[model samples]
Target: MKEKFLCWQTSGWGLSLLLVLPIVAIFYTAAGESDEVFSHLMGTVMATYTSNTFWLVVTTLVLALLFGLPAAWVMAMCRLPGEKVLQWALVLPLAMPGYIIGYIYTDWFDYAGPIQIFLRDFFGWHSVHDYWFPDIRSLGGASMVLALVLYPYIYLLARAAFLEQSTSLLQSARLLRCTPWESFRRVSLPLARPSIAVGLSLVAMETLGDFGTVSYFAVNTLTTAVYDTWLGYSNLNAAAKISAIMLVAIFLLISAERFSRRKQKLFQQELAHGDDVRYTLSGARKWLALIWCWGLVACAFLFPLMQLGYYAWHYFAESWTPEFRAYSFNSLQVSLTAAVLAVVLALIVNFYRRLDGRRMTLVPIRISSLGYAVPGTVLAIGVMIPLTQADHLLNDLAKSLELSPPGLVFSGTMVAIIFAFVVRFSAVAIGSIESSLAKVSPSLDMAAKTMGYASTRMLRRVHLPLIRRGCLIAGLLVFIESMKELNAALLLRPFNFETLATYVFNFASDEQLELAALPAILLVLVGLVPLVMVNRSLEKKH
Candidate 1:
């Protein structure tokens, strides 16, 4: 038993350390000097990068809350028409990448596009300075684009929090002659504040991590700066230093969020799963709520999706080239590989914790999960630092042995891309499997042990059967996340390699998003699978 515990416990810690190695390498590499590149960047574009990143995170969070909070409240509090469909439809935006939306909107709203042309002709305006129109390629536009997709994070959490609130507290507020709005403001919103904070943290982190939308819109943020600093300057150390800055910012953001909830002791009971607990809206109120919910769905998901469909239909022959086929296959191969590896790692560390519930056992799971919180671009740079070093060391060792150095094996191949994906998304798998495992009865473990079953045998026979559904869901979730991953893929892809994300991003960057519509549609359609599955699981849970 002691030997068995030693094996699994060390295995768990080893997996955690593998995930953490890149992050630690970032700090170590940042500690090294880099030919005054850091100084030049500090004197030049650093302030602009920092300011843009700050405002982008702040504005995007506010906008996400603006869109998400009201929808969450209405969904939880009211009986609306087609409530079931609307609830899931509102989350469809999570399937659409911000860059795709940015591309479609920028084209539609540009001067040469239909909307602007109609405005100009209808108002009898001439060419230059005839009227003012909102630009879809600015910082504000990037924030809106990001907020559209990311608001679902806030919406999901806030609605779950509201649903789980104590009915007694809300009733007391109503008994004291509080209006529905007043009861929500005084009793419900306060209880859901922590959940909102968590959601906001996720939104802000994603906004900070974003590369494609902001880059396409010509807004220079830290994520863009990191990309330019490395590729343009060819300075890995400087990029690592910048990534270290991003890690610091992430740490502060996470710490502040946790600190805010340190004293919060709120607990909630589940909301009943029927219409009796809901208030039915009528007349203009009903119409307004319906408009609020459905309007978001149309603008965020339906509109962009329609635009992509239109483009794909019109340009199907041009868009579906041999390269498109290769990129699609590449995306599938890489994402599926990452998903499987991530699930295996999650199972290893999570089951270790299941066996031993010590504080030390928990450390491996937590440490492994830290990779998800690191911004994708930052994680990419961190991944490069150690892997590049390993590649060089291997080459030198090969040369010393009078053998040909196998070139660019780790850092310059699919290994890096898939490794980064696994690290970035392992947390999603861990959370899903850990939650499923927590629901399994401990008595079953004891029962199996008394029946002369070893840990591995019991896990395979009992827990695996039970959590297989969770594992499938977890793997699918990771696969979709890997498919949608843009920032890291852009940074870490092998030479002459392009996933669907990077391929479409390149097309959008080169002013040819029309030609990119087919792959863009593929990205959106792939992402929708997990969202629907997750929504179904949530429904079943309730």
Candidate 2:
């Protein structure tokens, strides 16, 4: 039994180390000679890239807060018709990729698009010199696109924080002659700070890692710099250096968030019926809340989705092709494969933790999940370094053996892409499985063991059945994330291979979002599956 347990622990630690290797490889690769390249970049584009990355993080966080905070409060503390629908509706925008939103808005607001055309005719302005319009292809536009898709992170966290607030304290605030505004400012906001801060960190992590939207807008950030350094300039060491810098930034961002909340602890009771104490708003207040909440939903999810649908409909003939079908199939194949592998890994690590409750057993779980903190572009660079080395090693061995050299079998094939996807998305599966496994009481394990059930038998009869739903959810989440993944796919994909994400990005990059609309809409619809399932599951739990 001890041998079996040791084996399980070894497997967990080994798998976790496998995932961590790529990240370590980034530094190893960056450690190669690159002083000249570094100096060149410092003399040229590095400062601009650093500045854009910094401000993009700040601007996106600010915008997401502006959109998310109000919506979270209204949902948590107000009464309105269709409240349930609106609550979930706010999260629907998460299914829309930032690049898709950037494309849609840019198309509409461009010089030749309908919005500018209408503006030109309405004011009788003939040309660009006659009017001023903010470019949707700028840093500000990329931030807005990112905020629309990402604010839901804040919304979900802030809403949960609000829902769990102490109702008694709120009532006490009311009795102390506090207005609703004052009560919210004094009590709710402070209480929700921890959750909001965590959410904002996630947003910042994503903004820092974002490639498609920022790249599409011609806005250079650390992410784009990594991609361009590798591909455009063909400088792998410089790309690794950039990736190392980004990783440092992400680490600092996370550490700062943790530091901020270290001294703060809340012992408030969870209010199961938090909604019972919700303020009843009627007349103007009700209208204002409704507009504020649903208007965001309209702008974020509905409007962009409708625009996509319209474009998809009109361009169906052009967009829907055998090539499109092939890429869609590629997406499904890769996503399904990656999803299954990620879930298997999640189950392995999570099951080991379940069986061995030692504090050190948590190391694997923590290590396995670290991949999620890495951005896709950086991850791709990290993934490439080792795989490329392995490919070269294989080729050399084959040559020495007088065998046919299979070139780039590991690095320049679907293998590389799938590995990166699994590394990038395994965290989603691990979180879902870990959360689900925690719900199964330890007593059940003891009971099964006493009944003479062996470890495998116990997992089969007791754990697996109970956690099957979580496994499914984890798989679905991984699948949806894999389907939407653009950065790793963009960087790691083979010469002619394309997933739906890469396909849409390629077409959109050519200023032909019209031709990409079908795949873009397909991507959105696929992404909605996990969101809808998650919401339904949360509803059941609530």
Candidate 3:
């Protein structure tokens, strides 16, 4: 028994160490002194990068809260017309990538775009001096684009927290003659703080990880700096250093979120009725609420979707080429491959924890899952460092053997891209599988063991059958994330390789968003599958 346990523990630890190698490589490479590049960056553009990153995080968080909180609270606590439809519709924007949003809105709102052109024509003011028009490429504009997509994170968590709260507390507040607003402020808001913090932390991490959106907007963030340093200037050391800096910021944000939740405790009434006391809006208030929720849906999802649809229809003949088919195939192939591997690895780690339930097993799972929190850009940098070294070693070996050197066979290939995707998205699989596994009764494991079945056999015959849904969910979630991923794909893809994300990003970077519309819209549609599944699951639970 002890030997079998040790073997399981070893497997878990081994996988964890493998997953964590990229992060370790990052810190190791970043420790080297690169005074020339580091000093130059610090003197020239480092401050701008750092400040833009900070303010973008701040601005996006604030806007997401402003947009998501009220909507969540209204849906959870109030009775409004079309509430059911609006509830799920609001989450649709989550399917839109921040970069795609940036691309679409920038084209629509740019100085030479249709909106400004129409305004100029109507007012007979063609010159720049005639009026003040906000640049969609500014930092503020970038934040709004990010916020529109990211607010769903806050809404999902905050709404769940609100719905789960016991009605007794609200009743007590009402007994004290408290109004709905006062009750929410005094009781509900405080209880939901931890959940909101979690959502905010996720939003902050995503904002930090963003590359394409900020890049298209000409915003100099740490992620972009990391990319430019490594690829543009051919400075791996400096890029690693910038990636390390971003990693530190992410760690801080995660720590703050965990700290906020440390003392959170919720008490539920054991036999409480299913009835929830909700406030009803009427007259102008009803219209205002309806407009507020619908407007968010329209702006975030419907409008952009319509724009994409129009462009895709108009450009279909030109855009639907063999190359586009290749891009789609590459995306599906890589995403499916990554999703399967991630789920299998997650099952291994999680199964080990189920058998042993030891700190050794748990710690490894936790550490391995940390890659999800690391930005894709940082992960790509970390992954490239090790792969590049391996390539050099391979070339050296080939030279000694009097053979042709394989130049960049590993680093300049799809292997590194898939590895980065697995590292970044394994957590999604782990979390989903973990949740499903937690629901399975321990008696099933015990029963299988009593029948002389080993742990491996038990998992194969017992847990596997029960957790099929979880495995599917995990794969789907990971696939969607991998499909939409831009930063790592942009950094690590082989020469002449083009996934759907990279394809759209390339065209958008060149200010040719119309040419990229079909793929971008397809990406959005693909992303919606998981979102819809999640919404249905949430509805069933509520």
Candidate 1 structure quality by residue, lDDT tens digits, 1-542: 66778878888999999999999999999998766888999999899999999999999999999999999999988899899999999899999999999988898888888998998889998884989998888999999989998999999999988888877676667679988788778887999999999999999998988998998899998889889989999898889899999999989999999999999897666766552566789999999999999999998999888888888999999998999999999999999999999999999999999998878899999999999998889999999988999999999999999999998999999999999999999999999999999999999999999999988899899999999999998999999999989999998999899999999999988989888889998898998998888789678876
lDDT of 2 at 167: 79
- Model 2, runs deviating above 4 Å: 272-275, 447-453
Would you estimate the TM-scores of all the predictions?
0.97, 0.97, 0.97
lDDT of 2: 0.91
Residue-wise lDDT of candidate 2 within 190-305, one digit each (tens)? 99999999999999999999998998888999998898888888888889999999999999999999999999999997666534778899999999999998998998889988
lDDT of 3 by residue, 161-227 (tens): 8888888887888889998789889988998898899999999999999999999899999999999
Candidate 1 ranges with C-alpha deviation above 4 Å: 273-275
Model 1: per-residue Cα lDDT at residue 491: 89
Candidate 1 local Cα displacement, residue 394, angstroms? 0.7
What lDDT does candidate 1 reach at residue 131?
91
Q: What's the lDDT for residue 256 in model 2?
A: 100
Error of 2 at 3 (Å): 1.7
Report lDDT (CA) for all predictions: 0.91, 0.91, 0.91
